[model samples]
Target: MKAPRLHIPIHYLKGVGPRLAGDLEHLGIKTIDDLFAYYPYRYDEYELKDLAEVNDQEQTTIVGKIQSEPLLHYYGKKKSRLTVRILSGKYLIQVVLFNRPFLKRTLTLGSVVTVTGKWDRNRAMLTASEIHAGEPDPGSKWSPVYTACSGISVRKLRALVKQAFIQYPDCIKENLPAAFIERYRLTGKREAVRTIHFPEDQEQLRQARRRLVYEEFLLYELKLHAYKQLKRVSQNGVQMNIDRPAVQKFIEALPFALTAAQERVVNEILSDMGAAFSMNRLLQGDVGSGKTIVAAIALYAAAVSGYQGALMVPTEILAEQHADQLDGLFAPYGITTGLLTGSVRGKRRGTLLRGLAEGKINVLVGTHALIQPEVIFRKLGLVVTDEQHRFGVRQRGALRLKGKEPDILYMTATPIPRTLALSVFGDMDVSTIDQLPGGRKKIKTYWVQEKIIDRVIHFMRNELEQGRQAYVICPLIEESEQLDVQNAIDVYTHLSQALPEFKVALMHGRLTPEEKEAAMDAFKKKEVQVLVSTTVVEVGVNVPNASLMIIYDADRFGLSQLHQLRGRVGRGNVQSYCILLADAKSETSKEKMRLMAETTDGFKLSGYDLKLRGPGDFFGSKQSGLPNFRLADMIHDYRTLTVARDDASRLVKSHEFWHADCYAPLRETLAESGLTQTVHLD
Candidate 1:
């Protein structure tokens, strides 16, 4: 079937020229589909009411003739004000405006103007927020306030959207099954799109959004199921039989018993690996939730089947840490573990690579170096990735191709919100380790202004004196040429001067890799008492002795980002504290920081972060292989997500929709939505 002309350039649409097209592109509306999909973030009710009808503290618009010319006045040297009086029948409306001296010339006596603002009955005045010379633009009772650029007016966007709706009502054909839409009580696509932009009432808008959100989620969920199926097609790897005696011996040697959550997730991974299909699962746990141990158990299970396993991390430090750990865990059990990273010397790296290719290495851990063509594996049956988001989707695909469809395990410290996990990781089965291990301490967090930096430093000193380390994270690595934000170098210098007794060091992206490793190694070995750094340390720093996270300009970070920084501390049981010495300028930033101080749950923080920044900036949809919803908010429409997921799962698995010609259109729709990159079959 031919696709509709929805992809046509939006400039060709009636009343939109090249100038308006450029403005529309800023709003990501290059095509008719883009314009229609660009829904309003908010709405304004421009209900015009009589001066006598408006109640105090109500915002409304009024049309009246100015009875007098604007009276201009100066309030001190810093303020200029313009005041005007309008007559509506016998009711005289006093309008006061500020910082609008140009309005003095615009407000002519006996001129008709529309004023919108709040009425203060006690003061007998109307504080005008906007004064229009003519009738309200679009002249509708309800007006949409789109997320627009400075050059594109909402009135212009509304007009353009209305024209597209009229010209292309048939563009969004009734491809959706009638029975399906009826079952969900969803309005038709054409009707829903019309109502979304210009609703008759709040009820209509709600109905329209419900339909749009559900359809988006349903198609997205279907694609996820397809992707999972596509990846597991060659799941012909050896079934990793569970050797209980060896596993028991390994667990007995651990310093601590696995938490119930960790044990349960290990069982899940084991079950997946033992199945005919290759195990594709996500091991989601909060920072310090012991996901590494769970993954270790899975690796042991894979090795028990006489096949090799590879664990990949984002940084060389994390790779080395995992190798150091796995060596200790797997060595006594007669499982040979190896490390292959960029920094490994010639002879040692050569031996490790040869051992891996010869199947002598039972488990190998490294960074992107693991995916290099030369780092061949003999029988790679399992692939484990720590900090999964640190690597791109293509990187994961590359690693998987090294083996004959190896069982994959992804480990993430980022606790994805339940809604997001269902949508984003729908292709992979998710096993969450929700509980911290026994004796884990909850990190006490504090939100304070930068004025209290002295007190925070004193606390840091007290911790350091007890043989603990602290981290000071600045928002920037160097003083930006434009912005006045704090940087790592200046923070290190300032901290060194103020706390002269401690060994303070600095690190940033600008430093060579070796220098960065040296600085981090020094901190890890307690050679540096305080480390001043940027977000570089945000990902894989796992120092247990670091008990204090002193973040400068903490308000400059998003909730999840601040939470991740806080996760750097609290890794040890040393009564860790996260002191946010932030100078929050707005109430929104203050609220965000307060939420950070209130809870350590990354899932909750993720929800708040999504709401604050939307899905586009939440994470890279392209790199992460997750869809960026144009309409549906995964958090707000969580129920819809679940419903759609279940329905999509059922449809994808059922005989009729699974292989029937009737489902072709839906598959095509999914392909058009860009799911084909990850979810479509060959």
Candidate 2:
């Protein structure tokens, strides 16, 4: 049988054999479609310019004839340079090339060539970045620059692409409707695919890129909208009875009043819970915002409705913190609260598991242990996950699976930008607690050098002496030979000696669950006046008495993280302060420090952080949980993303679009887009 057109294996291409195909596979190009989808990361523009018109340090392309022999010089080990003098018009430009001694054999004397790079006009020098043997063509000014690896040159890949297009010119068909394309002024799918690799002009290239980006965003948004519709139409939720009187009574008995923001979020959550559809809401709040109290109301609603409520936190310490607060808050209302962490084992674990199975546990709070197989719930109606990003999708899904169809609520203290929130958590309804509790003061922040650290420590000691606790945060758990930053172990040792009169303890990820609990418990009880720890304590370790926080290598962290670390203090009204100890070398790091010292708004900081670090680095260690789009950027192309989302919303609103014959191509492309696999619509 003849080879397929669009789905043909890459090895079957005109020039790419099995060996070359293996190299292409490493770049995720295994078939004809994959090869086409692998778009260039950037483009290089080479425009023929007069030597007199080019300025120093400006990039320009010049055509010249080699007037001298190319000299090859070897400098550093495994490094060589090729130098040649080329006569262009009245200017004899000296061209320098690095690590390409083989070019000396190809560049013959008196041969006409085109060179592109930064111009050193004063010295009549052109540091050649790209050199072509023939004179440059003004018509073909733009060259596609693809990411390449060893054994697979970009030139070879470009040649293969050109051959593939020529061989299968009609392989790609239109997946988008003609009307949608005309309305958006998007180029045809096949035209865009061809022009993206070999554009005739800049305007055509721009249109091609825009067309591809729009399609990527539109398909992703369609999946998100489809997921929302599926949840609403297919999944039946538990219709919970709203015990308004009991809820109000519980709220009235609280020691502190809830902010308006908290009340509004609570109302939004409760309305979702009481609806016919299951609730899938994300609760976003800044640090120190009363998110816990809002979650408490939802949990209480579940409990009073005669259903069990489960709250999962990231760390065991956070679990204990929630369990303690919930126990005190629920004890008076005749509701039983239980904690199940990795450390809670043997008979206690069995008793807790038995309580959960028998419906005796009204509210359960724990870490990953809550997802254990034996931890069955009699009626798990509502599930709340704190720091939801910390757990993988499977972990959260496993807990949700424990219930028949539980209302899901995900809470995060890290504030996400609205654009990102829409894309990443598109399937969930979002509620943001924008206001902090009344009477909460902003944490006074300071960026100090290492030389002034002694003064900062003295101030910390003064605060400790005044009966307030403090925290010393280090970036590393232990000493690192590669890094010159302070570690928790060394910081603890230094603090223990520097402040000999005060009690100090160490907390890090290496500590056992039991040990971490003990250290946190001691800090809670004021048994330890100073706690030197790593980022393991970055999340939710509420201590109202801890009025000071000192972070070492603070610049090493992203703005969101530094804000989270700063939030560890300022829990009470004792006038908290956070001193960032960092010798920030780069201007970017210095700007981060200045921004931190300038503002306490977590949302503001997070927005700046997203813009500064981009979406991938914003979440730090964890994947941004965003679909990988070849041409669309969540941050840079936010406006296009918004338009695509609106269009998708309109499209998904009509049921016919899901099964109409005209939409079959879209559905097929969507299946291959990989967005549906990332999002669960069923």
Candidate 3:
């Protein structure tokens, strides 16, 4: 019997050892399958060209024979340069190689070599970036350039890949079915893998890439659909009785009316909850779009049915904020509300936990503490997580497991682009709140240069004199030598000195929880007239009286983030303003400022942000559950993604596909990949 070649440890390969395997692991390669599946980010062409046809400063490749002895020179410690003369056709071109003295041993007289680099025709020189000994086959000239790190080189990666192709010629088995392959006109899995690492021509490279990209996307969509399928079949959904009278009374008693969009989404959520299946929904809305009220209505419905509800946030301050807001909303209705956080200790924590277990707390709001094992729910029917991306899949699953298949509703103030929504939130239904509340004025936004600091300060002072609070946001908490931008501390000091009459406070992530709460609470009240902070105040910090927002180094932030910071103001009926102080010199930076000044639509800005920064950086950093595609770009390959999604959805819904013999390959691949192993199928 042949051993499982695909699963063999990478170090067992001909040239790779334990140390080299560890380095390869950084590039997400650990086994023989992983090594074969590794694809290049780009390819470099080394097609031999006629020396006479190449122009100055052009990237040209030439094959020649050495005519002179290689001259080696050492200029400094640990630095050496090698220069040689090579004759190609009728031209004698000079080749310069820097810091590579060992190459002198290989470049003997009359030895043929191939060099590719910029050709300085006027100087009769070719500055070589790549050099090889006697390289030329008819159709194999394009070289793959793998992304490298500290311990690995592109050459070594190429060599290892070559060794794999030669030794394990028939190791990789096909993952896609023959019918599907024929329908899509895709290359076979083994051939595609080999071609991706070393393609004979451009057309073959394109075909290989398309095959792998489609496969990746199909598998990804299949995994997501499988999760959705489990939820659909669980049969643990709660049928809650929405308290129409109590919900109406609460809404009528509110100071403002709900926007049409919010009402539509509320009905959608209520409809999902009343169904036989559980509700896995994502509520998308801009800042101050009244998502809390919609969530409050759902919680109220759950409470009326004698089932408990929990609201989890990313920060303690936001938790407390939600608790306070919900307390006021639930007070008159006689529904109990409680807060549990990391700071709640001993007797308080014990009391909260007991209240949760005894069903005394109808709705509990807290941070990560809400997911801890100590807290138990009597009958959890609804789980709402605010700023959903801040928590990972496991965190959300942990909260869901606190109950028996509780309905989940994720709330985000950040508007997710449609492409991301299809992939990241593919398993959940989405509801978007596009309209802001009535009586809210569009915040006046301005883009000013650093030279007009005095004028901007004078304008802010006027707003301060009118008893309105202001927030000054910087990108960093402390000065960074690498980035020349304003820090929170420096801004706080400067503001304190400039406006001595007003109370100024500083807040950042480095501060303790207690200290951060104190600063935020002071600013929330009218006690602190000016708040200086970093992006810590971006989410869940709402102050109606604070009408002025000045973000320093606005160019450093993504458009969506800048919109969120701008949202900190404009909560009240008063005329608010967002002053973007950035020396935006580049066209892209200037366009960002212009767009911020032109419109206040969060969705529009988010779409642009997704385009400007790819999916990986769109969330500022890689969110835990976001898919890592090797060759498929969420933006560029959207058509392929859509087709894959459609195919996956169709197949997942078909019962025959799950049990048929033809799909055994797909089933085996899905099982062995372990992508859905952690899904909460139970």
Best candidate according to TM-score:
2
lDDT of 2 by residue, 1-682 (tens): 1112247788777988778888999999998888888898876677788899988899888889999999999988989989999998989889999998889999999999988888998888999888888876655787777888878877777788888898876667787888888888889999999899878788999999999999989888888877787677664987799898999999999998889999899999999999878999999999989889999999999899888999999998899889999999999989999999988989999999999999999999999899989999999999999999899888999999999889999999888765568678768888999988878888999999977878998999899999999999999988899999999999998899999999999999998988988998999999999999989889989999999999999999999999999999998878999999999999999999999999999999988898899877776556445677898888788888888888888877776666566666766655654434222223
- Estimate the Cα RMSD of every predicted model relative to the unseen true structure: 5.8, 3.9, 4.4
Which regions of candidate 1 are displaced past 4 Å? 1-46, 51-140, 143-185, 188-190, 230-245, 480-485, 620-622, 656-682
Give per-residue CA lDDT, model 3, range 421-534, as digits (tens).
768776788888988887779999999987787888788899999999999999999989999998999989988998998899999999999999999999888899999999
**What is the C-alpha local distance difference test score of each model?**
0.82, 0.87, 0.86
Residue pair clashes in candidate 2: none
How does model 1 fare in lDDT? 0.82
Please, what is the TM-score per model? 0.79, 0.89, 0.85
Where is model 1 poorest over a 10-residue stretch in terms of lDDT?
A: 673-682
Q: Write the per-residue lDDT of candidate 1 for residues 1-682, one digit (tens) a residue.
A: 3342346788778988888888888888888877778888877677777767878899878788899878989888768888998986677879999877878888998888888788998887888876768767663666777876788766678878889887766555555677788898999888988888887788989999999999888888887876666656645655767787777777778988888898898878888888778888888887778888888988998898888999999887778778998999888889998887788878898888888889999999998989898888999889999878888888989999999878999988777765467577656789988887778788999999888778888888899999999989998887899877788889888899988988999988888878888999999999999999988898867899999998888888888888888999988767999988877889889889889889988877877887887766777665455567878877678889989988888776666664466666676776685545333234
Ordering by lDDT: 2, 3, 1
Predicted candidate 3: what Cα RMSD to the true structure?
4.4
Candidate no. 1 TM-score: 0.79
Candidate 3 worst ten-residue window by lDDT = 673-682
Candidate 1 lDDT at 397 equals: 90
Q: What order do candidates take by TM-score, descending? A: 2, 3, 1
